[model samples]
Structure formats: structure tokens, C-alpha cells
Target: MATSEQMEAYSQFWSLTLGFAAPFALKAAVKLDIFNIVSKFSSEQGATLDEIIQELRIKHDADSIQAERLFRLLRFLVFKKVLALNGARYGLTPMSRLLVSHGSSSDVFVGGILSFCTSEVTQRSWQHVDAAIKRPGDSNAFVEAHGMEPQDYVAAHPEFWKVIEDFRLSISTATSATITRVYDGFKSVKRLVDVGGDTGSFLAQIVRLYPHIQAVNFDLPRVIANAPAYPGVENVPGDAMDFVPPGDGIFLKSFLHMFADADAAKIVKNCHSALESDGKIIICDMVMDEGKELHLQLDMMFLSGSQRYQRTKAGWKNLLESCGFGSVRFFEADPFSITEAIKN
Candidate 1:
């Protein structure tokens, strides 16, 4: 007979296998708009199973099988802490509210993120990861599965880009508070440009914080054309590769790490040209350390061979210096590092 310790270890291994289904369930909950329903209808005691089923358009059957399935999903979600259970009722938890369209996290669109991640195209690419690794050179799993490069694939599918942009917006929202609190360089700059800034959220935050600074939200033509009007920020439509708007301070947040060295170099050089001799370039992105597992994992998830693409502290200094910046400095920022370089 197996020892209790051995049996427990085996049970944990099997439990992890069930983790794969969690995403799908979460996606279903989002699709059903369960969070909104609960938030809208539930009293302080919470929404009962019957109330939830009625809101869901699910009929309460005599046998209660379908109702039980829905109840099981809710029960599992409550176990996952996405919902709080009070007797037979369910209520929204903080994590679940992020999926709501009008909650505090409304801007992040976590439901959209879940929908995109669970979509067939994205999930299919994940299945080919092994094949991508086995290929000889620079093979992306997405390309292997979809027959086009990741950028090309995203371009062909507008929905994918929407998801990508939403993901970027979410990250920006999460990091913006810390950045505004810690970074003091924004005060002196006369004009600041946010390259590849989507929807002008970051730029909006900056202008709101420092009204003296004239902020420009610069991005692809399509992106800027659709950008919502932000007070005190000008929306400029252009390509970061071709040209960046001239400004005293250029800010790139979570932008450069997606590319390999060559493409990143091109963008860096463009920023160099767009800035005056006294201008400063501030890069808020991952500076990967060899020993940091979480950072390394994030790097891989964003780009293959992230070990080569994600810069170390020294790597960042060298890249900026080569691009004509006189000096470079790095500061620790959670989930990212702030790299500042100034021209001579």
C-alpha cells in the first residue's frame, strides 16, 4: 500500500490537471454575465440559486438536473473564491467584479481577456508549443499553427489585436499608480510623448497629474484615429517605426519587450531622432534577471527566446548608449523596471 505522503502528492498532481478547466469555467461565467446579474439583483443576503437561474434565462426543471449543473459551476466558482456562498445563494467577490463592464476594473475588460484567451485560434496555437520548440530556428508556435507570423496573424485578425490592446491597457492600469507615485522626472518636461500609447490612458493619467506638461498620445494611425478624446493630451497618428512626435520626454511603457533586438533597436533609434539634444527617454519595461523565475516566465510568454530579447540592466545601458544616449539609469518597479536615459 502507498504511504499517506505519497498518496497526497499524487492527489496534488491530479488536482493540477483540473486547473486547465478553470479558465473555461471562468470564461463561461463571464459570457453568462453572472457578475452583473448578481451585482444588480442580489440583496445583502445574496442571490439564491433560483434567482440566479431566472436571471440567466435558465428554467428551473422538475428534475433539477440543468439547475444542478449551473449550481455546480457556481459552487466551484465559490470554491475558487470568485463568488461568495451564503447558504444556497451566490454573491460577487472582488475578483469576479473585475469582469463586470461598469466596475472599478471596467476599463481592463477582464471578460474580454478571458474570451480571447479561450478562443479557438489562441488555444490552438498553445497546442503547437512543442512543435515550435523542436523547430531549428526562430519558430513561433503561433506561426507554426496559423501559417503566419504573430504580427501578421494579429493583423489579419482584428479581434486578436483588440484582445492584445486590452491586455496592454490592463497592465498599464495596474502599473500606473506606482509609476506616478515614484517617478519624479515628469515635472520638468515641457512636452511628453507616449509612443504606442493605446486609448491614451497613460497619457491621460500623466496630464491629469501634471497639468503643466503638454502630453501627446502617439500610436499607429488606426489606433490614434479611434482614440477617445483625453483632456490636455493631443492624439497623434503615426508609426513608432517610421517617426515619433517630437517631445522633451518620450515614454514607452511595456512596449519594447515584444520585439527582438533588431526591431527594438530600430524603435530606440527613432526615439533618439525624435528627441532634442536635451530630451530624455524613459522606458518602463521588464529588465530580466537570470535568476528571477517569474520575470523569465513572463518574458517567455510574451516572446520566444525572451532570454535574448528581454534586456538585463547592463544590456539596457548598452542598447541606450549605442542609440546615442549619453547616460542610462535603472530603477526597480514592480513587474517592470524604469530605465531612464538622457541625450548629451
Candidate 2:
């Protein structure tokens, strides 16, 4: 019933809509370790189905039927240009080569998306996107759809909790480049307090860099329960919302994005109060810009999953000002910012 121009628009829209198919396809590929196998085969000449199954040391039986299933999967990966197929052998494309194991380093390239997409909590919430978009105020999307909090369900089921933790540990590690870039000046910092510093993961680097600089790693008690006892680093279990330990430098990496404005304001205020006369607060969170295409997609992704959200440049400045922080400065080069301020 539409005109030619309208029909053309509709056709293009549907094609773009099919783009969602790629994420699921990629998730499946990563879950099956297809890319790692392909990359390994590339180092060898190439791998046939039997060779792939054997090399991967697959747990289950891989007979002719299973081999045929794997072949069909490889064909899809080949068609997607993530894997290269020469005659009957499979190899990795340049795009897929980054996922291979590096000596002993374990990097699951698509692990983040897989954990988010395939987690029982996230999977259940995916079914209610329409309801979430229609209904209005920001509520927990997972709870809204599933009728129970994701955390509660995760707590009740040990297997699901293990999967979630595996996904977190697999995805939370830093790339070497990112580590060097983010912590370029960490050696100069005198004393550091990592708020919500779950098990001293980020603080370990700082304490390692400056052997004398005391590190106070604060988080919920349960989170830092098994924290390793180190000489320069002190582990204390408590909520950052109610209180933060006093220190020279306050640090938070990717923790602020999990809180709403009021909660963030309180935490920042605590940080402001906790800092020594010459100290500053270090916030490492994604700053969103509406102008960038990728930023917009990331903004949407954050909105869909977590209730807490990113702040625009102006929004962050206002947030800082409201919390009695002065001299807010953002580094364009960094995904995070070292915003210095005083309590007046």
C-alpha cells in the first residue's frame, strides 16, 4: 500500500534490523571457541572438522552427525567473513585472529557480550524490551520482566552465580595497552583509596608501582572477603555510600556508572570529604557524547541493561558542581577523567 519511496525506506530499515542477527551469531561463535580454534588452525596449515574437534578437546562425542553440525557452523562463520575456508579446511580471518590465546594469557574477546547476552538474567530481560520501552520510569529491567531481582535469583542459584562470575572475571581484565594508558602517572601518586575496589583488582597495580604508597581498598565486606594480605595495601570492607576511608587520592574505576544521580552525589561528597588537603578524586567511567554514532549505541546499550547511566560532558560538570567539587577537568584522551576539586 506504500508508495515507491516509502517502500524503499521500509526495505532498508528491515535490512538494518537484521543487524541484530550478527550479535547472536558472534555470541555462538565465541561460546563454542570457534575463533580460537580457527586462529590455532591458521598457525597450522588449516583444520578439518575432525582436527578442530580433536584440537579443541571437545567434551562430548563428535561423530559424523556432530561433524556435519560443526561444518554448518563453520560455513556460517566463513560466510560472515570471520573465518576463512579453503577447500575443506578452516582458518581465521584477520578480524578473528585477535581472540586466540596469547601464550598463557586468557582473553575471551567476545566474553563481555556473551555474559550479558546469554546470562539467564539478561536473557529474561531481553524478552521484555517492548514492555520496558513502553512503561515509563526507570525501574530494574530484569526485575520488571522476570518478577524478581536478578541479584536475588543469582544468589539462589549457585551454578548461575558461577557462570556470572566466570563471565565477569573473563571480561573484566584489562588489555595491556589500556593498563599503560590509564595508569601512566600512578607511580607519582602518594597514597590511594580505591572505593568499591572489589578484591583490590585495580589497586594491586598502584600498590605494585609505588611500594611505599599506602593503598586502602574499600568495598562491601563480602566482596573483599578473600583479599590477599599485602604489605602496603590495607583491605577494609564497607559501603562507599555511607563512608569512604580517608586518604590522599580517591580512586574509582567503572563503579560510578552503577549508581543514579543522588547516590553518585553522596559518594562524590564522601570522596571530597575523605581527600587530604592536596588530594583529588579519580573517576573512571564512560563519558557519553550524543554527536558520536558509537557513543550513542553505547549509551543505548547501557540504558538497556543497567539502570545507572552515563553523563554527558555538561551533565558531569553539573554533577561535580552540585556535590561541592570545584575545578572539574576532563581529559579527552581518556575514557575516564582525573577531576580535581576541594571541599571549600
Clashes (backbone N, CA, C under 3 Å), per candidate, total 0, 0
Q: For model 1, how does the per-residue alpha-carbon lDDT over 76-146 read when each residue is reduced to its tens digit? A: 89989999998877887778877777645344445655665677877787677777778878777777788
RMSD of candidate 1 to the truth, in angstroms, is 4.0
The number of clashing residue pairs in model 2 is 0
Q: Candidate 1, which ten residues in sequence have the lowest lDDT sum?
A: 299-308
Q: Which digits, one per residue and each the tens of the lDDT, describe model 2 over residues 23-80? A: 6777766767766666654454678887887855553344433667677777777888
Candidate 1 lDDT score at position 151: 68
Best of the candidates, lDDT? 1
CA lDDT for candidate 2 = 0.68
Q: Estimate each model's TM-score.
A: 0.80, 0.80
